[model samples]
Target: MKNFLLLIVLSLYLHSSFAQNLLQPELEAFYNPALRPFYFGVASGDPQPHSVVIWTKIVPENLGLQQIHWEVATDTLLQNVVQSGTGEADSSSAFTLKLVVENLEAGTHYFYRFQHEGRYSPIGRTKTAPEGEVPLLRFAVVSCANFPSGYFNAFGDLARRNDIDAVLHLGDYIYEYGSGGPRKKKKNFSRPHIPNHEILTLQDYRTRYGQYRLDPQLMEAHRLLPFIVIWDDHELANNSNVSGAQNHDPNSEGSWEQRKAIARQVYFEWLPVHDNPQRSIIRSFRYGGLAELWMLDGRLEGRSPQAKGTGDPALPSASRHMLGEKQTEWLLDGMKNSTARWKIMGNQVIFSPLNDSKVFSRDPSIRMDRWDGYPAERSEIFDFFYKNNLRNIIVVTGDVHTSWAFELTGDPLNPSKYNRKTGMGVTGAEFVTPSVSSFNFDEVVPKFVTWEAKRRFCKKKNNPHLRFLDLNHHGYMTLTLTPERAQADWFFVKTLYEVDYRFKQKGGRYIEYDGNQVKKNKKR
Candidate 1:
């Protein structure tokens, strides 16, 4: 009987050993001398008044567990350490580790790094949002970073700047399309996506993210500053909504729900974002009394089908919702209760209506993918602000691939009805940043100059509220907020094709809410 018990125990021990081996397979086969275990580098996000999330991924040479030690210090030399801890890196989460270092003082700059097996990662810098009162706040805004099209010079430029508090990545952090698309034919891509195919599965998404993070420019941007990000269409699929996407084919891509789940899982795992029970990405961040940034999600959670064409009469239906009921309520309540001097909406798409009558017809032709498609919902939001007496609202947007500064007037079609002198019918002001690297109208058109001239003329003639427009440029915007006024300085890179590109100050504009006024500022 004793011998039989010993045999059973031995069998159990062997099974346990096999399970561990299965979870962590040999990594030597995939090892590269140049790629360290911390190849993806370090990143931090979701900053609060007292805490922030620090993230790192361990690429082990073997499948065994790795113990990662992290430290947060007031100085860059690690001499003045504030918080330190250790965590395990295992295969359960692609060997990724995220630690929420809490109980730190607010409005403070902190340096962080991770060490594994005696090898230390590059140090990262992060800062927590201010708590009570802040005299000033600054943020660098960017979006739509397509790796294959060009280099991330804009990100590198932003990384070089030391004035911004945090980086706001509106969306399209990574494009899922593989090579051989229309873009590839137009211009030779500097690099091709891994797998060389459209990503559809969790592993595929994770691999794509790994490839993007490998980019030195992008990696440096993450290493230098904390990023507050939201996923746009290309992160999952092109023109993606809640139920379906224009790029996703159900029969070929398998289940849409399953694909979305996989994409969301990978996004949450790879990014240093904090997830809630409802799996919603809509959240708010306050910078003391200076400003409150409401980062919104317009693609996934509760969006309806995009209008197909220019004259989709049903597009005006109230049932065609954008933020849905719950999120809309949350936004309205948040704005109503917010006491910050400036309420900045970190939105993915253009909030103000963009009308192009000459291009389409005498009637205003709107892009269905933006807020214009859901006319009733857009009107409801504007009405809420008007009725509630909300002021000092600044909408910072991306996704249009062009730079524009406009006043969100009540009647976008007929700007004359709204008094531009007093900004009487204007609810807010919008500053739309150009694409980081994605192709714009000029790049896509055969006759770039003619197309640009026509576009600018038509846009300006129809949309009088549009104070400025730069249809072709690749760069970002830096927004600075004070107690009195908020300013947005637009900067454009010399070129996206070159790795080492210089950014030039394009222009800038600011809004004063004391008397409801918008003005263009030449200062950068």
Candidate 2:
């Protein structure tokens, strides 16, 4: 009887041993450190209350499928591992790997990293959104990072900031153009593009992204914070719409459809963003009851061809649209149904109309690339907000390489129509972030005596709705949201030409919304 009991115990032990040995071969083979796979470092994005996507690119010495292992921990030391998984890095995705780690605590900061063979990647820090009630939310807003223009000092500054919750990149993640065009005279400009010409092919676009990702400052920024990004014109071409672009000549640069597909494909592959099945990057993120951010795709989703300057009388026609019918309806519905205190729109182009005719002795010329071109659609959105009695709507915009703060009125053509006594005609507020390095109005305009004064005079007189405009600074904006007010603080780099430039607070603006009325506050 004792021997029979011993035999049963032996059988159970053997079964357990066999199960453990089954995984040993794969585990032992994965620890080879000879292959330095994590070359581009790590990044995280599209964070939710319970999950976040962690990303890494493996540059294998040879072209084949490589198995990569990833792990997420509650602490920076990675001793308390919460989740771990293994994924494949193949040539299909340019060796880029993205893993969505789930079932995490809300409003919690996590440290994650990747492993290829025995080499480990740089640890990336990410945080999940708050679940119930958030007292404050802060985001660093940036855009239009033209690599050849200058160094990414703005990105470095953002990487050093420990206060920001996330980085909101409002498109132009990478430019398709090569060096020596308009930015030829930029001092200390060194990095040239990979293709060294206008990028049109799939490989060309992918190579451009790779070059930009390798920027030390940019990589460091991604390593530190999760980025909520959207694409603008430069990702595909200059002034691009749904069908065609000004920089993309179908007669010379192959089919527009093919080029657009490849660009979008590579964009998803390189960035740590969740690809929408619809191929549009338009999505929304909610921060408890503090703010609900709706990121809109204003470039490629469903934009009509821009009118020629502002001379075309059809600029205000209902036919022209920036965020086509479906997207517009989606935005309106989301805003109406949202329970958050602030409705924030992560828009690409300028939402407020800026007419130069009021200052310059010229026709009321507007850049058709912006919302001014699609006046009817803009009005439709405004009408919905007015009808719903929605308050605390703030549009954060990029694309234009200048910082601006404006009170969005009901009518751009007749700003005086709004009720000045009660502040009733205001639909919302708009804050435009300056470029990371892209040239602004100061760079393009010719140098002369009183140039600064003349530029200021033109901007102030032309756009009455504009409370502040900085045409020379190259930096980003910090948006702080609370239950009472939404504040935007603009920080500019001392110089983009220097690698170790300091960031100085240029100015700040705040909008306090009370019921249907809005009050503005400015700090110089």
Candidate 3:
């Protein structure tokens, strides 16, 4: 440990990790180390296939200012030329250079590489979204990755898949808390974080992002494809809403606005995202005419204080809003107005009915903090889809740290007969992707959890409109969207504690309940 500290300090002394000099050899450690090592790492995000963002950072001996060259190839052999470019990184943005390459065949796999200080980064590969209404848009959905809970074996497998198009991370990208239980810091960081604990400042958030970005599997996944990202509570504080957070007490932690601003600053600085003035991440992206992805900012514009959410578990109110007025309106307007054949909402929370046990006599306010918490808001959204006949609508989500695929039901006027075989509201379909590696019910509520997956599955098949639900396992789900169908492949990882990150694959079905009225993944 002392040797590691010595190395870090020496690296800092020779070349600043936060490079103060602007004209020196750019890819320096102090400016955010993108230095090469025995281990090869490369990354690309914010992808449009032909034009993608490639980034790399290194720690150098002198850490002088340097210019790096980037090349994008038509073939892995690099013999066939398509597009190539050059970019220089200095202390300004922390030694990371994002090269935007252009003009390639639609829906193609292009190899990219970076050249700096005579060292080459690992060959990074990225793909473009299919142009026309092709058969699939297979990619993973994940969130809330706490490094100590486990490894990102799931990310490793997803990165190896040459078939996937992208990754949709529905927030909790990295937790804002200190090491808990098994998840420990790789080393004692130089500067102590805010509150001597939780992240409440720019430096805190930046440190967390840096640690997460250092994960080889995570970086590999990002290098291989475009990532559609959104943040949930933990990015700032657990169970946070517009007003405050579950992890913060204004009396103890300072003003909520100040903490929020710091969180947002680090997130925007690290991630490639557009600023939403509405204070929500309710934005839309398209894949020609096949499908349109509407990512939500469920945390920022939501109603309710931080503690009253899942942490409170009993405050289900018709008036407790999640997507606040404006953002909810934005989501509705987008859903109602989109031209794509399939409408996929990247919701951070589960959007379907989630009940505990088989008890049908319990009150509706049983499950709080999720869509179950905001009954009225969920109703309005459900009614929009049902009334307008929004076909092939699927909500992909994360944050529960457990996997669930549900046949979305409708408003049960009295909230009774919810678990009954009949007399229930069933609207669309929602798939909840588990966390990359957060503790599930098995670990926390072990005795109560079961392996049958029946009662849970009943939540899907019982209500005429509900479809599927898997409450265990931590992995990502891939969706293949077509004009006539949209299929989801729920891939699982074998283990998260192991260091090598070996993963196993699980088979998941795709739904085609629109034109053909089938509910299976008929593979290409």
Candidate 4:
């Protein structure tokens, strides 16, 4: 009996050692064999006043159906369990579990966890949206975290903070690139894509996502805060549209339809978002009477193929759309009817016009992929705002990998329509958050060139309504909204080369309630 017990102990030790060795060298520190089958950790998202979605993944050693148990409680120890249930995972969903815990209290915090056999996954904390007279709300706005480009220091910094209620991820969560690409190095660290190839199939996308979730910072952030996420072009392919992506090759790789479908399937399976019946990602969250957030789907919905140049004949077509007709109507109508004091549009690209002639030599149509590409539709949205006399509208955008604050107006150049200095006639305000770790102007261009570009872009004579621009930085923004004003504070991480999490407040901008123009925040 003594010999048998010793042998059992030795076998268990070897099993743990082999499992640890299976992880990538860079991600080894984050991998915990004790969590076992539940390696991806836990995440919660799409929080409602009365419900929230909790997610997890189980990679069983054997290829078979796995019984997973989940629990939600009011205490971290999970002794005061509020909701409990069981779920089955198999190859069908890649063993990912996204379970909605319903009948939760409004404005309340909850602790949740998932279990397989006897092992328990990480405990995640999430909160439900507040209802009825919310005095304040804060969100960390972030985007563009390319895995191969750098480390997720920004996310690490965010995870250390406790002030933020939730994280608003405005897409480009992961890049579909190979290992040896141009953006494969960051300082001394060699961040490589897992598959070491351009991901194009179902398994490829899944593998990439698995690699990203293994990051300690991202996993910790998700474990602490609920995330409201939306995808941009990079999630599927570079500059993807309804039909095809610029990076996709139908002849060589596969059909665009098949690739897109697979990407969507994997996205829903992995993330904690609620998969509606129609699979339409356009959804709204009501924060009591204070604010209402509308997360838009700009990439896969109804966008026209990007124009080749300003001379492209399609640029002038009134039919060309960015948000498409149905989504436009839904958004405009929702804004018109919303009773919330603040209407926040969670956008994936720059909405205001940006004249890039002064900064770059690219054609005017080079920015056609953004709202500038679909001018007619953008104008229509502006027209609706003016016609309805909409007030307190805020557009939070990502994807540019830079920070910019714009005073939304009929036209920034037309003095008669918009007074840049006095800020007489403005439709709304837009705050563009910097990328989390993607390449900024400084990375792609020489330091001196980027300095010159920044100087030209921020010149008062050009783009007068442009209040602020930061062409060089890798960080996130904190958007704090109250009954009287909304403010965005930019925070920059010290470095992405290694595991440093120190950050500093770069700058900030704010707009008072009913004040359409953005103003520089008073220095602290």
Candidate with best lDDT: 4
TM-score of 4: 0.93
Cα lDDT tens digits, model 4, 425-516, are 78668999999888888887788988999888887777888888888888999899999999988998888788887888866888899886
RMSD list, candidates in order: 4.9, 10.1, 6.6, 4.3
Please report, as a residue range, the 10-residue window in candidate 3 with the lowest summed lDDT: 22-31
How many residue pairs clash in model 2? 0
Residues 426-478, candidate 2, lDDT per residue (tens digit)? 76678889999988766766555236534654453455566667777789999
The parts of candidate 2 lying over 4 Å away from their true place are 1-35, 358-366, 412-416, 419-422, 447-461, 515-524
Query: How many residue pairs collide in each prediction?
Result: 0, 0, 33, 0
TM-score for candidate 2? 0.89
Per-residue lDDT of model 1, residues 1-524, tens digit only: 99999988887787555434422222233334454778778999988889998999877655567799999999999899999999997776778898789998899999999998888988999999998878888899998888777888998898898898999999998888987235424355356676588988766787778777877888888988888988888889988899999899998989999988888877887888876666667989988888898988888867899886667878888888888888888889999999988888888888887775455454343378888877788889988988998888899999988888888666755645476666777766899888888877667665566375556544545776777778778899988887877878888988777787677887678887554556788553
TM-score for each model: 0.90, 0.89, 0.79, 0.93
Show pairs that collide, candidate 1.
none
Question: How does each model score on lDDT?
Answer: 0.80, 0.80, 0.65, 0.86
lDDT of 3 at 306: 28
Best-to-worst ranking by TM-score: 4, 1, 2, 3
For candidate 1, the per-residue lDDT at 170 reads: 90
lDDT of 4: 0.86
For candidate 3, write residues 450-488 as lDDT tens digits: 454446545443333344555567777777766655666
